[model samples]
Target: MARARRTATRWWRWRRSPLRRRIDVAEAWVLLGAWLLAVAGGLLAGLLTTGTVERDLDRQRSERRESPAVVTTDAVAAADQAPVKQIGARSVWATVRWSTPDGSAHTGRTRVPPGTRAGTTITVWTDQRGRLVDEPLSGADAWLRAAIAGVLVAAGAGGAVWVGGRLVRVRLDRQRLRQWGEEWDRIGTQWGRKTG
Candidate 1:
């Protein structure tokens, strides 16, 4: 039993050498960098993309607010009332009847995405030019945007994790190779000798 214990201890000690440790450390750093970079890139990309979308939406909103138009909201009663029809993905084209500031109503066609659904209350703005626009987002709309953003963030996190794992694996392999080299050197002089 004592001899067996000694053998096990010897084996364990041989497995962990300085070269192996160095390789392990180096590999760790590589993976750490990969993970950090992936995370940073993902965050930056998400921020830029989402920000761009928000800015465009905001610009359109402001334009609608500034125009000499009227804003009105009503529930879409049926298919006839559907100002925009869901045709292609996020593409809707329809004509809608909306009110004006002078207590007058006009019917005009508007093109929007398919996100607007039947039975949803939509706000419409019409200018003196007879150009009609709709408020695409409401309180629930903001929440939905946030949810989409959250999904993008999650995807970024996943990318980071994947990169980190790859880096860790690379480091482990380097460590093993370094350890093997050092072990070989140590055993070279005493090759075929039973002592080592």
Candidate 2:
């Protein structure tokens, strides 16, 4: 019962009260609208962003393909840079040659296992044009990216709505304060003369 009374009193601006000014009602409406928009708009934005990201990732998976390539030079001898850990193996940059479906040959530098011997065959990723490219994101990776993007976009949308509401509330408070000051001045003048 006490909690119910507290909740009811919390909405005093919406109740019939002579002390409740027009500004108070306007502020109440702004609060309600802001909350509604923040929830609905943020949800919509997040879903749209997530879907778009997922579709793009799916397209990448469809457009990229793996091809066999032969290392043109010994990785340990040709690689001037230190090996880096990739795909659970220490890799060094080495030139590799591959052929496209049209029997055309292409060579590009790619990461190969350290100490890879010349003429060793390795799998490499390539785009439709036969240019070397990074491996397409797996299903789990794509979902994680989409989820992160959705969360960030949702938070941004909600924050923007909340800031807009705060600005409106601040403006209303200033207007109320100005009106109070004016009323105080007018009433203070009447107090100069005694009623008795």
In terms of TM-score, the best-performing candidate is: 2
Determine the backbone clash count of candidate 1. Answer: 3
Model 2: lDDT equals 0.91
10: Cα error in model 2, Å: 0.8
Q: Residues 1-196, candidate 2, lDDT per residue (tens digit)? A: 3554444578987998999999999999999999999888888899999999999999999999999999998997755554544454578889999998778999999988889999999999999999999999999999999999998998899889989999999999999999999999999999897887
lDDT of 1 by residue, 28-83 (tens): 56666667766676677667666666666666555563223221222233333666
Model 2, position 29: C-alpha lDDT score: 98
Q: What TM-score do all the candidates reach, one by one?
A: 0.44, 0.86
Candidate 1 ranges with C-alpha deviation above 4 Å: 1-19, 38-50, 65-134, 150-154, 157-161, 164-168, 171-190, 193-196
Provide the global lDDT of candidate 1 against the true structure: 0.57
- How far off is residue 139 in model 1, in Å? 5.1
Per-candidate clashes come to: 3, 0
List runs of model 2 lying over 4 Å from the truth: 1-8, 82-89
Give each model's whole-structure lDDT. Answer: 0.57, 0.91
